[model samples]
Target chain A: MNGKYRFLLAALPLAVVIGLSGFFYDRLGKDPGELPSVLIGKPVPEFTLPGLEDGAPGLASADLRSGTVTIVNVFASWCAPCRIEHPMLTALAKVPKIRLVGIAYKDKIEATRAFLGELGNPYALIGADVTGRVAIDWGVYGVPETYLVSPGGEIVWKHVGPLDETVIRGELLPRAEKLLK
Target chain B: MKFLLRLSSPRRRPGPFAGRVPLSARDPGLRRDDARGWRALALATVLFLSAVPALAIGVDEPMADPAMEAKARDIARGLRCLVCQNQSIEDSNAPLAADLRHIVRERLAAGEDEAAIQKYLVDRYGEWVLMRPPFEPATYALWFGPAALLLTGVGVILWRRRHPATVPEAEALTAEERARLDRLLKDEDPA
Candidate 1:
């Protein structure tokens, strides 16, 4: 081969090697947990924890089946989104044929009660996950993740992140109404 | 003594060949060694070329516990280091990424749930810290862009590979150029 062509031929594989190196390097550092969820429409993880109110009953999976559609809200006293979603939660609680419960994730009992007091109680039954064990059991990535538990106690739908009035009227209500029947 | 003198004589050194040859001219075997030297150089270059990338990936600092490091890596994979758009906080060595990793460990150590820790980060940093942005109408493009790009790239590559270059149609040859080509071919050059 001519000198220039020989040099070019040799450099082609080097270029490909550089490209492959960059591609693999880019892929190797990828965060695997960011994998798009496969859990949509699947049954939610089960949890049973003590209810936040003193002398009140603890919450269990069976409680979600008490002949009412329930929203199991995963919230923490420190979560700002939960505060933003509070009014929507309160509104949803007032919606007939639907009930709302709060699961206090990784928060102290006193702080959770104080927060509820300051922001008007919206849950019919509140559960405390003081060590956050229950939140993990629910596969929660963050709050306020609301799960719509059917009257049969099946976790029919999950809303990850804060709730909004739009979600209430549009997505959650439409789905919960179907499950209610 | 005369025979010994003839053997040691330098009389041949004054000929026209004085400057033309060096000591290696005495050995025909060494004449072929130039080819061997070129082959050795090519071999050395090929070996050096293959060793570079293998050396680079192996040089990272070793973590104290590869298991917790793997977990930290897994958690970091889900977290976006706010300073960079393309890298996970786990893969980033940015000061903020390091601080976020430390906070994750601290939360884990405190018996806080993984969800609570992630939620705390989201609360502090806003949802932008999440590697996988939440599914909402606002993020529909992000969620769907990869598939769209894949299809677009495939279409482009396939089109480019299948299309052939068009040959130009015969042009009306310029009078002068046609005459010149005809003369050269006929070996006449009448012009």
Candidate 2:
């Protein structure tokens, strides 16, 4: 091999090291708990869920298509994160023209009422998902997942874990502000 | 040597204070030691390979129909458990995996074929839900990268072998050195 080419051969290990490191470095910053949803840009799954209580209005996919953006929060009384992110959900419900509904996933009706009584009710419509069948249709793996649906009923964005001030203000609000305008 | 030849003896039998025979350190020319090591290595490899299937987790309750149950198991084997990314739904004990199993069984009982049921899951969870990813433009690199790397490595090795680095030629020994070399070769001392 030529002297110049020998230098190239010698740097092979260094090159490989840089290449491998660069590949992993790109992936390292991403949160493993956050999974990319395939439901984005697709219409929300059609279904009717019974109300968490008899008097409360139940949530349905049709309600999302009333020419307004909807924020669907999947939560349960048993999930700790749901309690933590409840204030954020309450704050979101205050926003005009953006409908915020809740699905009480796999929780008893009495438990749902007690939870709402304690934490305060933020949802306009609450769905009772005792068997979590509706959750499966929505492709929810864990509780306290939030989904943003477009005015046309297409799912636009999703946050996998609990909502925080940063995520709501930076991610959820900005996208919502666009649709609302 | 006979005592040392008991290579198969349990290591714990001879405590640190007892039978302090560091056979490897004592023996330098014993090539037979590596034979035992190689045999043990082969046995370990065989045992490990045989246990691979046993490592797979068992499935949940089977359908009443034997044929339907077999079909459901086959479908479950392809779907991944969302809770534990590495385990298949059939092999995982996660609630989500169980829920997915229930869905699969229900859908199958509803007369949906395996492809349709899988498609229903894929629509919701994306290709990540499948144990085997689809052969698309995005996954072409993932599917073929290993084989490409292996071929490239073989090519580089063969190229290196074909064009070996040049070695410098040694200068011829002078007459005096040759005579001294011959004298040294002829001399012998019997111990």
Candidate 3:
């Protein structure tokens, strides 16, 4: 073979091997994007957070009643995926059987209020988790995490990431309905 | 697309240019000129586009969207921490790393484009901030060396398989080897 062709032949296998390794490395290193709940089947963390809506009295663990299925959503004004998932939260609010509440994780009141105002508040009671201690207790790695709390205050399921219409309709509602029954 | 591909592709030149400049008397003026030219280019690029100050402007003020904060964290996790090698900004606790994380959040809340945000960070911290170093002459080995090594290894294995080493089954034993074996066995004998 000529010099250039020989060089090309030598380079081709090297390129192929590298491309294959990179493809596998990317595939193997990728985060599965599913955050498994450490709080599953455990009691919901006890917290007293200031309410976002009426600015009324704060919400506490005692507020959760038995026999009702509630979705406690952790959100912040700074989370974009929360915005993506807001419509789903709003739709879930209209479902009478499911009580949807929002926890404003480590965010200021003004920002939280503006965010809700623009997105349309779907939460029955929005709690300000100012210090993020409550969020940490709930094992929240990031915002837009939702937990399904049984009437008995037992956290039955958690869905990490944004709650889209598909997630709410498919994963949350079906599981909640089962809990309610 | 071609620009992006170029940015992502690793380029290696194993020619004479790849070696470091030897500080010898040979072509001293020319080598000095080359080094100076590269230094000037790096400095000019750093100075012209550095938007480091823009990171601090909007953070002190309260944001209108708290949700963007979470998005910022997600983006930061994807971003490599400039000051700390091989660590994502979200996972790093260094003061500059923290500042970078806060800046990313602030910028995201202010509605910065992802590419622009990445570029802004790169301009401030240089290409080192990027976890996946852009394919360039300097980073060619980091990106493509392993594959080259693997190919070479496979080639060696194939060559070894095609040209197996010959061995003598019986005549291989030398006189000295036979004497040593006999001595070893005699020492260990029960009799």
Candidate 4:
């Protein structure tokens, strides 16, 4: 072998090893349940969902575009994690200039109402997703997905699973506050 | 297509434990590890199903038009079942998969072409919905990385062949080696 470039040839195996190790190490820490959404920087999908009940005002894409940062939560009475994340959402609702919206996905209206009633409704507006078509438009795979839509209707941030204090304090609040600025 | 073959990508699932607790309600010890068991079971089932054809779950009502229904199936085969991960919507028994299947049928019934139907899904779920991703800047590596690696390997092999490594010249035998060689030659059995 040529002496000059021999080190490069010798380092090739080590480079491959390091590269593969780094790749697997990154994979090891990642939660397999977290699906990377491509919609993060895009505008919220256009949707018009009926109110949880007939009389109550329904949620529209326009509502999100009403010059306010809307925190859209996809929840369902059937999903258990929604209960776990309900309190953080309530806290978020108290923050001024943020509209906390809820979409009840694939749940009966009565059940949804009863669940919200028990949890103490933190949502400014609740939309019924009886057929789950609206949830589909939102690219909601399952319940308890939260999205932070800017006043301009862009999805600023999203959390797939239930929200905890760590997520609210660390991720959602900071992102929403930035959008506010 | 090769990356698509690697099953299991995350999309965030409900704590399958929290949702189903019929056994755990009565048997306390059974609750904790049940989710893992179910996940393994589901994975096995999905692998088993994928080994066979993309079987219709029989839950979906087919479109009336045979031509349209065939088109729906063709499109559905390319669309992924989110919950089932690698399994196509046609193969998955999940409710959401059924919803997607119906949506495919409905779109076809509405006289939408295959491209339009795919665009609708892509708009909602992004390019991930397609089993075969579209060629774009972001996916250029995925589409051509293997070929690039193979070409580099071939180039290296050809270069090495042309620029063959210099092997050391054979050393001159010392007096001891020469004497030993002569003795060995003399001791050789003559036929």
C-alpha RMSD values across all candidates: 19.4, 11.2, 19.3, 16.4
- Best-performing candidate as measured by DockQ: 2
lDDT of 2 by residue, A1-181 (tens): 6789879989999999999999999989687756799998899999899896567679888988988989999999999999999999989999988889999898998999899999999988888999898998898989989999999999999998799999999999999988878
Residue-level error in angstroms, candidate 1, position A137: 2.1
In candidate 2, how many Å is residue B58 off?
8.1
Ranking of all candidate structures by their lDDT, best first: 2, 4, 3, 1
Cα misplacement distance, residue A19 of candidate 2 (Å):
3.8
Could you arrange the candidates by TM-score from highest to lowest? 2, 4, 1, 3
> lDDT tens digits, residues B1-191, model 2?
33444555443234454447665445543445557766777898999998876554344556889899888888999999888889989889888888899889999999999889999999888889999988999999999999999999999899889988778799899999999888888888422
> What's the lDDT for residue B45 in model 1?
89
**Location of the lowest summed lDDT over 10 successive residues in candidate 3 chain B:** B5-14
Judged by TM-score, which candidate is best? 2
Interface RMSD of each: 10.8, 1.2, 14.8, 1.5
Across A99-123, the per-residue lDDT of candidate 1 in tens digits comes to 8987898789999989998999888
Residue A31: error of model 3 in Å? 5.3
Chain A alone, TM-score for each of the models?
A: 0.75, 0.92, 0.79, 0.89
Tell me, per candidate, how large a share of the native contacts it keeps: 0.00, 0.84, 0.00, 0.47
Cα miss at B80, model 1 (Å)? 11
Could you give candidate 1's per-residue lDDT for residues B1-191 as a string of tens digits?
A: 22332334434232466447653475454435545555666887888987864543232343466665566557767988755657876666554466567667666656676678788777444577788889999998998999999999999799767875456699898999999788789986456
Among all candidates shown, the one with the greatest lDDT: 2
